[model samples]
Target: MRIGELARLTAVSERSLRYYEEQGLLASTRTPGGHREYPPASVDRVIRIQELFAAGLNSATIAELLPCMRDVDGGPGENATPWLEQELVAQRDKLDRAIGDLERSRQVLDEVIKAATGR
Candidate 1:
């Protein structure tokens, strides 16, 4: 499939997809006309890439961890090693801290909204 098709299917922008390619988190081939050609596997790969990014993992970390990721099932696949498992633990800790921070922020916002609305 073409980049655009993959982007639409994945709900990721074409520009981000290109960026992923540049970061080596994704792989693609070029058509004879010089346009990008992605295989069907790229769909899940892109989703996995996005998930890792959402966990606050940088592109380099994501690149290193990609092979350890499983699609659809959203678990660590057989490609996982001791090193990658350690990285996952660290990333998960980061994400947990971020979630707590956001929850606190949301509670503050709720209070502000209630005070302003006199509710």
Candidate 2:
């Protein structure tokens, strides 16, 4: 399919798709007229890329990890490298800390609300 079709199917912007290609995270073939043509599986690839980015992985790290990873039922898989595993562990630790901090903040907010309104 064309880039536009891939974008529609994946719900990713065309600009982001182009950026993925530019970052070497995605690949596309050129048609005879030089239009970008993507494989159907690109939809899953785009989703995986978004997930890695959400995990705080940079584009370069994503580019390195994509080949060793798979999008299985919207989950990450085939993670076979020690470095990648370590990175994932670090990201999880960071996420856990952020979640804990948010939870504490929410509790403080609840206390303030209860104290101010006597409710």
Candidate models: Cα lDDT each: 0.89, 0.87
CA shift at 63, candidate 1, in angstroms? 0.7
The digit string of per-residue lDDT tens for model 2 on 1-119 reads: 99999998888999999999999999999999999999877888999898888888799988887877756465555665677767678878988999999999999999999999998
lDDT minimum window of 10 residues, candidate 2: 70-79
After superposition, candidate 2 runs with Cα above 4 Å error:
53-61, 71-79
Overall local distance difference test of candidate 2 = 0.87
Give lDDT: candidate 1, residue 45. Answer: 89
Candidates in order: C-alpha RMSD to true structure: 3.8, 3.2
